[model samples]
Target: MPPAQSALVVGAGAVGVSCALQLARRGVAVTLIDRGPVGGGTSHGNAGAILRAASPIADPGIVWKVPSMLMDPTGPLAIRWRYLPRLAPWLLRFIVESRPERHRANADAIWLLGDQAPDAWRRQVRGAPAETLLSPVGWLKVYSSEASYRAAEGGRALYRARGAALEEFDAHELRQLEPNLAPIFARGVLHADGLFALNPRRLVELCAEAAVAQGAVIRQAEVVDVEADDARAAVTLADGDRLEADRLVLAAGAWSRGLAEKLGAKVPLETERGYHLMFETPERSLNRPVVWEDKSFVLCPMEHGLRLTSQVELAGLEAPPDFRRVETLIPMARRMLPSLAGAPTDRWLGFRPSLPDARPVVGPSPRAGAALLAFGHQHYGLSLAARTGEVVADMALGVDPGFDPTPLSAARWA
Candidate 1:
């Protein structure tokens, strides 16, 4: 297939906007479309920390842990019992991905994107107000239990093997690093190269602005249907109008699987419904994003206030939001940070586009040469958006992306 001259990118979240920015920078005419405002989806309600040392969720032995995790009401992982039947196939694939060999491959693939994330972000936001968007204080993961801390050795070894910058801290040192945090932690690990966004939604908006400045068009319309052929790709909006482009990129995050199937790639994409609670703080609380390792939640200090982001509910897209999953974390959050006592000011529920293997589908559609796949980023969409954008742009422009994207290809499911 020839290089695309114009492209239609669906979704205006971090990944889609970043893709539009990269494509526009490469002189491709781009139309970025979304039903909601920029970043209003999962991109808006997240911890906002880009963890370089973070590993894939489907770690080895996770298969054995899922049942207990599902049983625990306060556990980080949850599944709607009614949705279990519908989610069985995806869960089976997830179990397969949790095998040691598959886990290792997925971890390595995740690191490939994570390792290049920071530099790609810098290049993407070169002329934008990056300082206002990003904080360099890094990410902190605190463990409250000795057993949990000990269980993290494998991940620590993985980080060391990957050459990711991280430092371990004793309980006293953890308290010293964040005085506001209670001294309940036994150990802490600081990912020194991590970066956090001050306001995640605004970050996506800025990326869209940057892309528009480069001649990319932003459209607020729902893509009702999509089609692709050897020559061109087109999308039909909810209003009955069709938009055509030389190529089509589906970066629609959680809502991408069906459209990808329409484009001739039947990917086993599932949504990891995540929830977050926002509390108003009169003053700044923490220096950076801090995660409770055992609880699997993060207390991120954002521009708006302190955010308690956590949970992985396995409800489908149409399921009602279960605010209780996040609401139950309040006591734990208060135990971690004594200052977080008042009722939450805001509660948010968003869907994370996840694949069983913990890798995104980031290359060309299997049977449609004119269509590209770029979703299934899972939890690291914000972290890997810039790098994924660069890869998508390179692929669309017929230029080398500098890395083998085989692990992230949808054909693995085929």
Candidate 2:
């Protein structure tokens, strides 16, 4: 192995921080750089769901499946036509990936990344409490229409192949499982291995602080550019400070696409804008995270309060947020959780870095000096972030990753 080297990680969200911390632990003096505060990117205010198999969006069927959803105002996934011009290339790749063959391949890679992701998190924190770090409570899926209930078979099979448990329940059994649910619901599915964090932002912050405690330098600086020589790379901050290192890791979440472009690498990257509204405090709402298929939203009893989150908008990074998109969810959230009678004290929007294929962009960047690319994780950032870190560190140390890196390598889009 090469001598202990220095690495500069550009981006301090879950992926960047995790990679930085993991590398530091492996004897690589690490410095994490970010445009804003640590955990300020998409990592800070996600839906907080740590779903094992529920997050990847590589459905080869979704291309055909999205038309109706796009036309309907209340549909779960939406895209603004105005941004369609910019989103054309991304949408094209998305459509092509909708093919069954491509979707399965992508899904397989993501499942591998996600399945053991939790173990990496456990390894990262070293004895973090399960209660504070995890909520083993399984996920519940409630559907009002029989057709929608049956539609789950396709996804259920996919989960089973990926090793997630899918337990079916009749309307009667569903009512028994969730007595508080409205009688309007008919049938349900239990994602038996479901999990979500009690607080995602807190977890990122804790990881960053932990990394700092262990001698990793965490800095607040927006990376404007990166330069590479024959044998090393360096990141240039917005303020003109250039920090040099032997290796570079790019984990900049939604903002990572532009960096890829700057690096002269072509990656089919786009942002899947996600929104959330959290009430003042936990109203002591029902237990577990509920995916209300009928309502196209989820009401999670977060440590702070009920967080109603869901909706995918394909606007480019420069597009302004349609607060109404977040606002539109209020009524449906109330319908899902009857006890949630209060308006949210806070609202937010974050970018879930997405790829044309719905899997993460991982492994080394080939356009320049030694670089590991770990972005485009979309909704699975937190759930898969730590594992990605371990892999990045393993690559830097020239250690076997124990899994194939072909799917995640930056060479795919080339």
Candidate 3:
């Protein structure tokens, strides 16, 4: 009888960490590798909107919206001019797939994937030595305009359909709920499913620690290449090191697509370059995370400081991080809450691993069963980490995933 083969997981972001932990938990020999600092990527800088009720930001209307969205540099979402010419076609496909029907379909698929996200995280964190995950109260979405407020109102039906609890808050009610909000902010919506982490760095760092404690090996090296054959997979490192594994799970976030291309799998993976700024503590925050409607970012209260993160720049991974965008977040954040103080203590910009259709790619590679590709989670990467690990692990074990992963696959690109 032969021994079971080892599994190699590339990338050490939240998704990669979660993948490694679940795989190791199942008793697979797991080796987690990364080129740079682990968890230094987008996982650390996200808005911390751990939404169990999150949906893709792309709507069929987005196709039409992109033209205008593309024009504004400081718009909530935009593509840099340098990256625009190459991204035109992808922009088209994104809009085409964002239709109402497509939105609902994608929503169903995404909801399926996110259904048990929080519960899975809770279970993983239960035995781990990680600091508290601020599942804090709930999430608030503020709206300055009536039209936008009404648009948010429509989600009530969608949430009810999906069996997720959602509530709409008028100006007075919203004010009562969050007394600190500026007077100009008239309406708001609260979703009970929202969760946040005060220290995302701590979250992923502790996850890595827990994973190592559970016997998973962490290799600090760049994976220059992953060669797949019928019998096994071999990963070559930039440092001229090589390791073998029976199965390869590519959860490398933004870098996953480029690596997937090495295997001749061309995925429509886009990078949503995101920016976040953490300010000196004004206080514990208005209680929970708030998705400031007009500004198009979520202001979260973390242990580090009041964090403001938003702006999705869809370009390639090679594109530079726009710290200026992160810098811009402070003004909007300060305006929303007068108490937020003068300036941020620290700012960060990281590229979010995004897919053209704003959904993640999971399951077997289009080419081989041995090549498992998981990335393009976009803004929901952290939120979807645990469930995606379960989904990917289920596929690897030949067990049935509780939901359909067809909506999230490389075949979509093929």
Candidate 4:
């Protein structure tokens, strides 16, 4: 394979923009195409946590709780009855991947990318406007009960073994750290190296700007189809225009499955619809992001307001936003922080492109010689964006990526 002279990247979210930036930096003529303005999709609505010490999604404990969580409308997880049939196949695979051995393997792979996330971001945003978007204040996870806190010991141990700097705080110490939190929280674990984005959407936009400054072209058009031969790839736009390039990178987030399939890889990808609520007039502001263990949500002080974000709804992409999921977060937020005031000023719903095994597809497409697959990042898309872009660029430029790419290969499904 020869180094690609030109590349076409689909989707303009974090992953796509990062890929464009890296490709442009390598002197490759790159065109980034998206339906709307940058960061308007899932990349805009996250909790703004640059979580590098994130745990794997294939936990056996969560598998046992799935049934009850699905049945409870107010629980952390929900599934639309109408989408159940379509979601069954992915759900079954999700369970199979929860086996102890598979779970450990997936966890190790995830940690490898996650542990390097901070450095990657630092290198990517060194002198760019995006540098101001990040806050390295660390993240705190609080538990309301002793048993729940004890159950998290295994995860704590795993993270510690992976070289994460962690500190456990008792109820008194936690209260001293964040005086605004309610007294109900009995224990807390703080990831000392955690980073948060004051505004996640703006971060992506700035990255896009930097890419443009580096000579990447941004095309505000939707990609309808893509075709590739042995030597080059062509992307057909919704307006019937076509673009030919030496390589194609699919980083389209939740909408990537169809595109990947066209490249000859059928990924078991599902849309994990997530909801969030933003409070405009919070009674108090927190110094860092906090995750409630039992509730499975995150409360972070953003540039606009205090954002309460979490919930995994197993509904297909086309379904309407169930505002109840957004509404449910208010009471939970109040319970955690009694000082929270005023009604929610904003509500959002975004789809996280998830895979059954919890690992993203980040290498070459088995079927398409000139195409590379880079989506299915699930919840870690924002955190893993820079590293993924670097790896993808390395692959496109015929350079060594310094590690085995087998773990994230799209051929695993084949």
Task: Give the range of the ten consecutive residues with the poorest summed lDDT in model 3.
Answer: 1-10
Model 2 alpha-carbon miss at residue 182, Å: 2.5
lDDT of 3 by residue, 274-382 (tens): 7777777785257888888766888887766788877877666776666775576666677788899866788777888776567788877777667778888887888
TM-score of each: 0.97, 0.94, 0.93, 0.97
lDDT of 2 by residue, 266-314 (tens): 7888898978888854443656778888667887777877788878988
List the pairs of residues colliding in candidate 2.
Answer: 60-98
lDDT of 1 by residue, 1-414 (tens): 788899999999989999999999999999999999988889999889776634778888687888888888899898888998989999988888888888888988888788878778877877678547888788898998888999989888888888888888998888789989988889999988888898889898898988898999989999999999777999999999999999999999999988999999998889999998999973538999999989889999998999999989999999989798789889988888887868999999999999988898898888888899999889999999999999999999999888888888889889
> What lDDT is reached at residue 42 by model 3?
79
lDDT of 2: 0.79
TM-score winner between candidates 2 and 4: 4
What residue pairs are clashing in model 3?
Answer: 60-98, 60-99, 198-302
- List pairs with backbone clashes in candidate 4: none
Superposition TM-score, candidate 1 onto the true structure: 0.97
lDDT of each: 0.89, 0.79, 0.77, 0.88
Which ranking of candidates, highest lDDT first?
A: 1, 4, 2, 3
